[model samples]
Structure formats: structure tokens, C-alpha cells
Target: MSATQTRTGSCLCEANKFTVKGDPMLFVVCHCMNCKKQTGTAFMSNVMFKEENVDITGCQDVGQYADSNNKSGSTILRHFCNKCGSTMFGKPDETRKTGVVYIPSVLIDGSDAWTPTKEVFAEKKCSFVKELVINSPQ
Candidate 1:
């Protein structure tokens, strides 16, 4: 595919570069405990796209962490760049056949057009998180 047809991005150290064609089919903010720890923040901004649309053209040090306690009851394969330790995306273990590449929004190159249209695992969200939105004047 032509470079202009895709969005290109890389890990913090630029050791791993990737490209995704087209916008995500789904965008979400996850507040599950695992998300907090995975992102080292209150929540994680995720952009889910069809797996075949994404291409990690360069990377030999991709690391993976299989999470067994996921709410979906399916093992979550969290993939990241081992060089800079940047958490990139995730996929449900082969058995689920979800075919979705759950990528961290910040890792996707381009503008800030992406926004979470949904939030999941709200019960696990920190109390302060609600205040930020509720207290907003919007």
C-alpha cells in the first residue's frame, strides 16, 4: 500500500515501527485495573482496528504478556516493544478469533482526532475519574 494511505508510528525509542490503514472501527477507554497498570495511568485509550489492517513491518523484539484474569474470560495477549518497553496493542488469544488489534491510542501516529466513544469496566474506575467529567462545564 502507498505510504499516504496509512498512518505510521513507532515505539518510544523508534525500535519498532508500524502502520495501520484507515481509521479504527472502535474506540474506547478502559478503566479496568489491568488497564491502569498497563498504562501506568487512570485509564487507557484504545483504538481497535481489524487485525489485517495493521502491519508491524519492523521489529524483532516484540514482547508479550498473556493476561489470564481478563473480564472477557479470554486470554489477552498484550504486545509491546521490548526495546523501549512501550505497550502497543493487544489481541485475544487465538481461540477467541476476535481479529481485533487493540492498540494504545497514543501509539498511533497522526492527529488527535481519535476519542473514546465508549468506556468499559467502569466499576473498577477510580472515584476521582468521575469527578473530572462530571465537574466539567461542558
Candidate 2:
């Protein structure tokens, strides 16, 4: 959890990998329909960080899709590993303009240690899901 520590992560096939420098800027759980469909799960845990802090290797194996069916009415560029079809990260054009990247927590190794600071689209949360109580340091 050191401020300057670098964290490494890879896709299911290990064909695509990345290293993120420093701590994450934000950690959020999203219950949006888009997230559920994209991840094929109830919700998605997104760990956000400045793009400058992330270094991705195996760019050639990474593919992207333009998601235009989001609730926020913005097209999100979703990146994934072509080899294993593992979704890696997303870049909302607006957020990308500001140099921010939202990586799926499941794709980041050791991300379970990070607590969710916020939850989005709670109205769409599943009935069996329990809300998380987080105490953010900031």
C-alpha cells in the first residue's frame, strides 16, 4: 500500500499485462446495467487511476470496443485481451480527456485489499447484494 509502489496485473491468458504506479485515485463499485453485461456479473468493481500512472505491455494483444449503450449517454472505450477475452479497463471519453483510466478491479492483482470508496447506480443493485460501508481516508 505504499504510495509509490507498483502493482502488476495480467489477463486470464497472461498475454496482456500492465503495471500501475502509485496508489489508485479512486475505488468504486458500479451496479449499472452496462457493467453487469460487460462483466457478465451483478456488478463491477472499478479501480481508477491517472493514465500516466499506468504502463501497459502487450498492446498488440489488446482489443477495444466502443460502448455506446451506457446509462450516462457517453461512449466508453472498453479494452480487453483478445487472447483470453478478459476485460481489462475502460476509458470514458470525458475521463480519458482528463487522463483517467478505470480498470476493472478483477483484472488487477491484489486489488481485493482496496476498499470501495463509493458505489454507483445503487438503484440497479441486485436484491441479494448487501451495501458496503467504507471509510475513505480522504
TM-score leader: 2
Question: Which stretches in model 2 have alpha-carbon errors above 4 Å?
Answer: 94-96
The top-ranked prediction according to lDDT is: 2
**Which runs in model 1 stand beyond 4 Å of their true positions?**
1-4, 131-138
Candidate 1 structure quality by residue, lDDT tens digits, 1-138: 243378877789988888888887777888898888988999888888898888976756799999988677779999888888899778988888888998888887772666566787888888788722211113
Q: Cα deviation of 58 in candidate 2 (Å)?
A: 3.0
Candidate 2 per-residue lDDT, tens place, 15-80, comes to 888989877889888999988988898998888999888888545698889998888778899998
CA lDDT of each prediction against the hidden true structure:
0.80, 0.85
TM for every model, in the order presented, reads 0.87, 0.91
The 10-residue segment of model 1 with minimum total lDDT is 129-138
Candidate 2 colliding pairs: none
